[model samples]
Target: MDILLSICAFILAILGIAGCIVPVLPGTLLSYGGLLCSYFASYSQMSTSALWIWLAVCIAVSLADYFLPAWMTRRFGGSRAGSIGATIGIFVGFFAGPVGIILGPFVGAVIGELVNDRSDFAKALVVGFGSFLSFFVGTGIKLIVAVGILVHVVADIWVHVVADIWPAFWNWLTNLF
Candidate 1:
């Protein structure tokens, strides 16, 4: 049962990493969930304070994820419409794969800008560039945080298993390879 929980948690961690790029999944949160699972499996071994800290970070990052793109849009002189369009584009881009994910926000921003002001193509382009940059930046941030959480979880699990069950750890490692 313990091994099964660990396996499921590891899978969730991998999914969280994938989610960072994919956008449809709550990458950081899901990754954190994996840690939570691992914690449950070894409740007495895991540090409660450490878990709380991770949860706090995850929540903060998730909240920031929502605002960064829009904030970035406005920072680059994009109108509210452009921000909204970029948000929508993120959802649409999910269906189209990586290239589409990169382009969707940019194109959407441009279109939104154009719709807002037909006379300023140059400004629209600028806003589109801002939106594009923001998307990539946001994705990078999510990837970093999710991976960090996954690493922490893995390390925590490693400490528990290696310290408490060294023989089992060595046996498992040998078998895994």
Candidate 2:
């Protein structure tokens, strides 16, 4: 049962990592959940403060990741159409694969602009550009935070595991020097 729980935790961690890049998933939160679960499995062995800190960080990072992109797009002159297109592109790109990821936002913008007015390509492009720029920036920020959060989770787990098994030692079998 313990091993099963640990395996479940690892699976959640993997999902969290994927969530970081895919946009549809809350990578930070999911990753943090993994850490929490691991601690839960070994509750008697880990400190409570560490878990609490991680939980707080996870919540904060996820909140930032969620809000920053929308704020950035609005600040950069993106219109409702541009925002919608960018969101659509994000989902559409998921189906289209890597190349589609790059083009999805642009395609969404063009279509959005065309829908509003055929001759307003220039305006739409501008809005689309803002959306693209904001989204790109937002995703980058999100990725960084996600990586940071995951790293912290991993490190915390390592320290916890090591502490739990303190005094256990193995003779070095390899001489790298």
Instruction: Write candidate 2's Cα lDDT for 42-119 as tens digits.
Output: 543557786777678777767765555345445555566656666677678778976676567766765665666677
Error of 1 at 170 (Å): 10
Per-residue CA lDDT of model 1 for 86-139, tens digit only, reads: 777777877888888888888888888888998999998999899899888888
Candidate 1's displacement at residue 90, Å, is 0.9
Task: Assess each prediction's global lDDT (C-alpha) against the native.
Answer: 0.82, 0.63
Q: List the residue pairs that clash in candidate 2.
A: none
On TM-score, the leading prediction is 1
Give per-residue lDDT, candidate 1, residue 88: 78
Q: Once superposed on the true structure, which residue ranges of model 2 sit more than 4 Å away at CA?
A: 1-10, 43-73, 159-177
State candidate 2's TM-score.
Answer: 0.67
